[model samples]
Target: MNILVAHNYYQQIGGEEQVFLAECNLLESYGHSVYRYILNNDQIETTPPLELLGKTIWNWDVYQEMRSLIRQQNIQIVHFHNTFPLISPSAYYAAKAEGASVVQTFHNYRLLCPNALFLRDGKVCEDCLGKVIPWQGIQHNCYRGSKSASAAVVTMLTTHRLLQTWNRQVNAYIALTDFARDKFIQGGLPVGKVFVKPNFVDPDPGIGEGKGGYALFVGRLSVEKGIDVLLEAWAQLSTKIPLKIVGDGSLASEVNRATQQLRGIEWLGRRPMDEVYKLMQNAQFLIFPSKWYEGLPRTLIESFACGTPVIAANLGAMSSFVTPYETGLHFQLGKADDLVTQVEWAIAHPEQILQMRQNARTEFEIKYTSSESYQQLIKIYEKACIQ
Candidate 1:
């Protein structure tokens, strides 16, 4: 199959960027010819605000380029990762115009929320859900705290909704989880067009022995991630279990401060993937305390690949992934006391943790391996072509 993958890269590299690269590599590894059309957020630095807003609605250059690429390559499927504020929905029309099926991966809830996170004021806010125009987002200045910027995104969404671009142009929408698929459906995506496919970890990290006594937390240190809840939970613990945090974000200073005041807390800021994986392999269990509706975090899958049981918040998609006392355990979202209790339980039941470790590895093998993901991708592509 000839595939043209399009993505708009963020200025700061993130899970979506990694997933985009991994999918491209996954396709090429299976002998599929893959071509890429990429736009970076760095371009926003130089682009005038009005021009950026104009391009967000429809970029003629991107449309012309995509048309040419599809025709020249005879692309069977044009898979899109992210197309906000740069590549635009125009690319989807361009692909369909050239007789290529369009498959868009819903990495985040951009179609439903201007911020794409459904997060506002440190909590999950779905004020725009099911609304044809996200007027609430514009009123709240949801995108980058700029009302004008939010208005631009709202305009794009409203324009596309009116044009039936989302409904008609895109053949398939790949959602990362069943929870996300449901949300997209509630937000007005066609039920038949939406499909659930979780992200996979390539070149499997292999199972870990669970030898390390300490627990691990691997993600950004931000409010929505429940970092504050994690800190409070650590403070409440009767038995101080060694905890290593691996990531950097807005709350770096707060995390750094916690390391000094809290016993058995180590802050390893922004390590490379190799180093992070090493930590995952050695840790007794991984902690995911996110408080929002995450689009199936890659970190959780990575932990499973390492055969590490997770102690995650019982909220959103995390609740679906972590089976209680099976693959891992779940704590009450944003409740430090519940988290502490779960931590103590995990500490007391070493044998159960061992069993969970094996189960986590088995889960990874069954659901998250690159081979399984590739097969799923092929089916989605086939579905798009048939549609």
Candidate 2:
């Protein structure tokens, strides 16, 4: 099948971008014809706001370009990764009008919430979850903490929503978790149109022997990531278990302060994927101290594939993946003391930890590898094509 993928990339590099590229490569690796129409937010630096907004609402240029591409290439399916602030929902209509099936991956809650995070004021705020106007998001300045920016997002959503673009244009929606799928359904998307498809790690970084004695934390150092909670827990630990933090973010200074005051804590700034996988292989366990409604964190899969068990906050998708005392242990979200207790327990039970590590790898082999993900993706694509 000839596939045309559309995506609007953020200025900063992150997981979403990685997944988009990985998926493209996976499809191509299977000898499928894949074409990408990608836009980057870095263009905002030179592009005018009004021009960007006009394109975002309905890029006539993208429509014409895509329509011609569809006709020229005889594209059968259109899969969209992200379309925010640019690329627009117009791509869906354009492709559909050109007689191509559309399948979109709900990487974030952009349709329901202006910020696309469903988060505000350092917590999960679903006040605008099912609202067409997302008035609460505008009032709360959800996007970039700016009312103007939030208003723009709300405008985009409301505009497309009233036109019935989401439901009519897109043939299928891929939700990263059942929780996310239900949320989209509540937000007025057709329940039957949405499918749960978790993100997977490609190339199968096979399970490795954990040699590093210290526990590892690999992610952004932000409020929603529960870095503060992780630090507090580390501080309270009676045992001197070394902790290695790999990733940089908004809370770097604060984390630096804690690292200075706390012993047995090492803050390693952002490292390449190869280095990260190596770190995962050597670590005793990965600490996923996230406090948000995360869309299937890729780190968890990477950890599992590396034979490293995780100790994550018991919330959102993490709760679904990290079964307590099985694949990994989970602690109450934002509870430092509980995290400390779980960490200590995990450290003490060496045999159980090893068994959990084995389970973690098995989980990866069964569900999170590229081969498994490819089969699932092909099934979805075939269904979309037939529809």
Candidate 3:
């Protein structure tokens, strides 16, 4: 099949970028022709704010590009990863008008909420979840903590929604978790059109023996990531479990402060993939204490691939991944005390941790392997084609 994939990339390289690339590669590997139509957020620097906003609602250039690609490639399907503030929901119409089946992966809640995080003031804010306009999100300045910027995002959604773009244009929508699927449904997307398809790690990092005694935290350093919560938990833990933090973001200074205050925490800024895998191999378990609803954290699957257990918050996709005593343990969301207790439990039960590590690897092999994901994706594609 000839596939045309569309995405709007963030300035920073992240899990979504990786997923977009990996999916394209997977399709090409399976003897399918894949074409990408991507827009970078870095372009925001050059374009005027009003122009960008207007284009975000409906980029005629993107539509024309998609129409030409469909005719040139004879695209049977067009899969979209992200199209916020640039590529626009109009791309779906472009594909449809060109007689191509459209499938969109809901990596975030951008269509239903302006912030896309559905987060505000360090907690889950669903004030805009089911609203037609999501005016609350605009009022709260939820997108980038700037009302004007967030207003632009809300405007795009409201405009397209009033035009029935989401309801009529897209053929299928993929959500990474059942929780996310349910939320999108509640937010008025057709329930039957939405499907569950968790994100998978490609070129699996072979399982490793946890020989090192340290625990690991690999993600952006931000308040929403619960980095401070992780630090507070580690500070109170009676046992000295060494923590190696990988990745950098807005909370670097706060992470540094925590490192200074805590004895065993090691803040190892951003590292290469191989280095991160090594850290995962050595660590006792991965710590993921995110406060917001994650689309599906790449780190969790990476940890599982390394045969490493995770101690994550009992919220969002993390809760679905870290099934207590099955794959990994779950701590209370945003609670340092709960995290500390879970950490202590893992520390005291080294043998149990090892068993959980084995279970984690087993889970990855059964669910998140590249081969498994490829088959699932092909099935989704075939289903879309039949519809």
Candidate 4:
């Protein structure tokens, strides 16, 4: 199979970027001729506002370039990752116009919400879910907290919806989980076109010993991530159970402050993947305090691959992987005290936690291995070709 993968990279390297690279590698490893076309958000800095806005809605350059690439290279499938501000839906039209099947992964709620996170004012919001125009997003200045920026996103979404580009241009839409798929369906994507495909950890990190006595939290330290709850829980948690925080984000200063004020809290800002895996391998359990309806975070799957049980907030995708006393424990979403309770419970029940480690690893092997993911992806590509 000849495949062309398209993505718009974020400035700060994140999970979406990881998934894009991982999928491309997986396809190539299986003998598919994969070519990549990527645009970075760093380009946004120098681009004029009017030009960027026009490109965001529809990039003629991307459309022309993609058509030529797909046609000349005889690309069978075009798997899209993130095409928010720059690549736009132009890529979708280009792929289809060139007779190439289109497969877009719903990495976030960009189609439904201007911000793509279904988050605002530090809470989970659904104001724009089923709306035709999503004016609520612009009213609240949701995207980047600027009404102009939010309006740009809303215009992009509304323009496509008006054109029926989502249902017409794209053949297959990959939702990372059942929850996300349901949301996308509600957000007006065709039901049959949407498919669930969770993220997978490649080259398996192998099971860890859990010998490290500290609990670990690895993700963006931002509001929607429930960083406040995580920090507060750590502050109140027993000092006997140390907590190690990784990753940097908008709340880096806040996290650094917490590390200084709270006892037994270690702040390691953005370690390399090997080091993160090593930390996961030795941790007591992984802590995920996300408050939003996440699109199947890659870190959670990686934790499962590491055989490290997770103590996660009982929100959408967070609760899916963490089955109480099975894979890991679930804390009440946004409740610092409840998170502390779960952490304490894990500390008290060492034997139970050990069993959870095995279950987590088994779960990963059953559903999230590279081989399993590759097979599922191939099926999606086949379906996309005929859809």
Give the least accurate 10-residue stretch of model 4, judged by summed lDDT.
231-240
The C-alpha lDDT values of all candidates are 0.92, 0.87, 0.88, 0.92
Which pairs clash (backbone N, Cα, C closer than 3 Å) in model 4? none
**Stretches of candidate 1 above 4 Å error?**
none
TM-score of each: 0.98, 0.97, 0.98, 0.99
Off by over 4 Å in 4: none
Q: Write the per-residue lDDT of candidate 3 for residues 266-328, one digit (tens) a residue.
A: 899999999999889888889999998899878999999999999999988887877898778
- For residue 292, what is the lDDT in candidate 3? 85
lDDT of 4 by residue, 226-279 (tens): 999988888888386888999999999998888788778899999999999999
lDDT of 4 at 131: 88
The stretch of ten residues in a row with the least summed lDDT in candidate 3 is: 233-242
Distance from true location, Cα of 332 in model 1, Å: 1.4
* 2 versus 4: better lDDT goes to: 4
Mark the regions of model 2 whose C-alpha exceeds 4 Å error after superposition.
Answer: none
Residue-pair clashes per candidate, as listed?
0, 1, 0, 0
RMSD of each: 1.2, 1.3, 1.1, 0.8
Q: Kindly list the per-residue Cα lDDT of model 1 for residues 114-231, writing each as its tens digit.
A: 9998989878899999899889998999998999999999999999999989999999999999999999999998999999999999878888888988999998888889999888
